[model samples]
Target: MKREMEDVVIVGAGIAGLATAVALKRVGVRALVLERSQGIRTTGAALTLFPNAWLALDALGVSHKLTRSYDPLVKGSVTNINTGDVQQVLFSEQAIRPVHRKALLEALAEELPTDTIRFSSKLAAIESQEQGGGASIAVVHLEDGTAIKSKVLIGCDGVHSVVARWLGLAEPVHSGRSAVRSLAVFPQGHRLKHEIQMFVDQQGKRAAFIPLNDREFYWFLTCKEENMTGEPEQIQREVLEKYAEFPSIYLDVVRHADLSTISWAPLMYRHPWRIIFGNLNKGNITVAGDAMHPMTPELG
Candidate 1:
């Protein structure tokens, strides 16, 4: 018996991988998106798709729709926690749409073709070759002893991409800081202004809040990179204890949140165009998104 070949095999079904699938399919090419995770699960806090990111999605032909504005009571301001001096402020009032991470992923997935994504296809290595007919060929090996051959290979496996490793790219560099993020509901009566607020300390710690929907606000606290191995209860208590002296509005959001919904990660980044594999003359293998250049999640 003989096996079949695919046009392109994508590693990672994240925002970048899924988006690429849509783009390739629209151009009449078949794409297979492989995800290491067992399912399409999104962890971490909510996100604000700023104007730039929205434009990118729009160019991809997907619209960014929000059920409702998150921060109607927002009073935009950035303050220095140590000196109490204002660094930036927008006195003018306006609503900024915020969306849940799950909602955003679902929406993006909806735009892609079905049967193109395969979960649990953790990549192990890639081999390149020249072909006599049609597009050049590259082979991908998965951790579970499954091997897929494709005419083209794209690595969208994120910052810790195995494709990058197979290409001998260096590991992502730590940015010296870590971020703790979450989304919590602040009761209707406790609705905050629609302005984003940020507090930065001289010790390299920071906290921020942005309302995504009427009832809930997205909040985050960043501190020096440290190990997080404590129980959820302990993690929750430590988060609250860190900002015990914050204003009532801050506490109110935390009051409605538990450690289960909290998320944290150390910031990291990778160089652009770190490595290029596959048939360069034929353009069979390529990389995209964080696999190409991983960076901190700042404004977006």
Candidate 2:
């Protein structure tokens, strides 16, 4: 195996990993990001970023770039699908904007030097120890016979993180709820308001749609599930059937949405109590993001 050394090594090139690297770069610390996938992640629809996320980006010096890229969404409302009652959504100087994941990642990455992220470098195992001077070091073994030694090892991998599993953190708990999301496109364009709209029924089912643009909108459906089984095509059909009674606009969007962009995810979470009592770090290894706090996307 080829041996390489670095100041820090981060696993998983998701939002957490790239964001961390960008923040570190502001302080002159460059980390080597190892992603299991072949390239940068480009999935998911629009993500709502509140004030806290913007504050974090402010510290990293990229908040202006994000603000420029995404339009501001200052309001959202909840409507009952059965009763057709709408609740007013008001904000006092608070603004939230929905930004595409790919654009956000690209914005963060633009601040760093070239080739900062190494693609397809799946981590297979890790070995760590205290050096003769009592300083800690970790050696990460990749699947392709490459060993990386670093003083700091951070895991930003998602819920199924290998690093979190090795740390003996409790397994993610099934929340009995699953979700499917897709970006709906309208060739003729839509007259929907720019604000976010959520439609829910009494059966604990939710269908929310947020406009991405005049021609494209991002939507998601969350419902109770017995298991995370089913083919993509089957799940797509099931989602359509589940929300068959929703408002006409929602129904039309779901029906005409791109099946290829639709995705299914079973919400899973580790208990917050375990994070306080469990080992968060051992030597030079630690975890962040979904790896540290995997939960339902309700508050994410």
Candidate 3:
């Protein structure tokens, strides 16, 4: 029997891949998403969907579903926890909403068709056609030895995308800093007024805390790259040690944290204006999001 072909084969099931699949489906295209992981894992601390992304989500018809479950950050003010000084207030006047990374992924995943995603399908290689004038095709070889052919192969795989490497794209550069993030449920009777605080000390290290709906507050700490590779327990200890001089409530928050919630990653990014991947001869192979340009969380 002849091998079957997919209209589109997207690698990775992160934000970019899922959103692209949903968009393609909306436009009447059938796309298959291949994810290396078994399922969506809520690992990141929190994510701020900038106004543009917010609008994009609205256009995609998922905005209401997301907003309904997440608390819009009606108020946000940056503070210098070191000296107890206020730096600049985005004030509740301007609307900025923060959502848990996991929640957003869950919602996006729910919007997608149940049969569209193939998990544990790591891309091992991609064979692209370079000759002839006919429509180009891409063959994606999965780790499990299953080969999938498609008219278009989109690499939505994250920083270490195999498709990117297969296409000769350079590796991602580290930003020389590492960040640790954690989310915790506020203790009973401890009412946390909704506020997002950023504490910058004299040493240049920084920490942030934001209150989400349901009495959950997200906290993060950024430090030199050297401090981030250790175990999570050590990282949590280092966080406590570094922020020891802050207000009692700040330290108290850490003390009461659910240590298991902490996660860390060394910041990495690709040049924004640069097109790491060459032009697709037949518009059959491309990349999006982190695969194209992974960057720090500058809220851009």
Candidate 4:
């Protein structure tokens, strides 16, 4: 199907895509956002957005509504899951609060005009054309058989992005590690403080819990050299069994975790050097966020 030409075509409706679209709109640039999924993907996890993230959101006029103070960062605890050794670590007293993934997405979307996003429009392919007069154009193909041509194209399609692949970026390098994450809610309410807690076994098995509020906490477990994969229930079971030997406090977190929210994925990243020298864009097309730089969550 033929669609109207757009000024900018942004692939993916995640934070990066929506933020880009909103920012472009500030300068009288209209963007068409195409999301592969039927709706926004909410993983039921909380994210501690740093200062830079907030600053950018503010620039796009989205921060005022999302600017509510959350629990401040104080001391974080790291434990030796095997030897029972605990180390208390001090964190920056910054306002880096853990916000829910759904809330963050909704806040960003709210600032955008209604119908700015088109769902189930997964990118199929991209073709670059050398338009004369020093102007370039991109023809974007969607899985749904709709083709759109735009003067500029932005790739926020995330890791394993079709746009990134079309750009001939390097292959993803697996770290040979797998991670599982979930949120645990205490209906009776937890009495824990606002600090973050982490435990690591000698073999690189690690688990962490960050309190979102007094009644709920977010948690994740990581194991090295694992190729575990299956249904959601199987993934949750693997997470439970991997940290089965940890102290009751940790096991309790896993026990109380919402099984539906539990998820597992092997760690993978593009080599940093490749990212530094990688061909990010061709013609009028470029990428942002994971499509540009995807690092481990630990580095953040």
Candidate-wise lDDT, in order = 0.71, 0.82, 0.76, 0.81
Q: Give model 1's TM-score versus the native structure.
A: 0.85
lDDT tens digits, residues 1-300, model 4? Answer: 776688899999988898888888888888999999999887636676677877787788866665563566677889996787889988666546677777788888877788889998889899987888888789998887888999999999987888888888897777777778788889999898888889998888888888888888888877786656687767767766866787778778777887767777777788888878989888789998878777666654
Once fitted onto the true fold, the runs of candidate 3 whose alpha carbons sit more than 4 angstroms away are 1-3, 81-84, 91-94, 187-189, 276-283
Clash pairs, candidate 3, are: 269-294
Top candidate (lDDT): 2
Candidate 4 ranges beyond 4 A from true positions? 67-69
Question: Which residue pairs of candidate 4 clash?
Answer: none
Point out the higher-scoring one by lDDT: 1 or 2. Answer: 2
lDDT of candidate model 2 versus the reference: 0.82
Better of 2 and 3 by lDDT: 2
Per-residue CA lDDT of candidate 2, range 110-168, in tens?
A: 88777789998999888787798777899899999999999899999888888887788
* Shift in Å, residue 290, candidate 3: 0.9
Q: Which prediction has the highest TM-score against the true structure?
A: 2
* Segments of candidate 1 deviating more than 4 angstroms: 1-3, 67-75, 91-96, 132-135, 187-189, 271-283, 298-300
Order of quality (TM-score): 2, 4, 3, 1
Q: Estimate each model's TM-score.
A: 0.85, 0.94, 0.90, 0.93
> On residues 104-190, what C-alpha lDDT tens digit does candidate 3 reach at each position?
777778887898998987888889866477656798888788888898899999888777677666677888877888876765635
RMSD of each: 3.5, 1.8, 2.6, 1.8
Residue ranges of candidate 2 with Cα displaced over 4 Å = 92-94, 226-233
Worst 10 residues of 4 by lDDT: 64-73
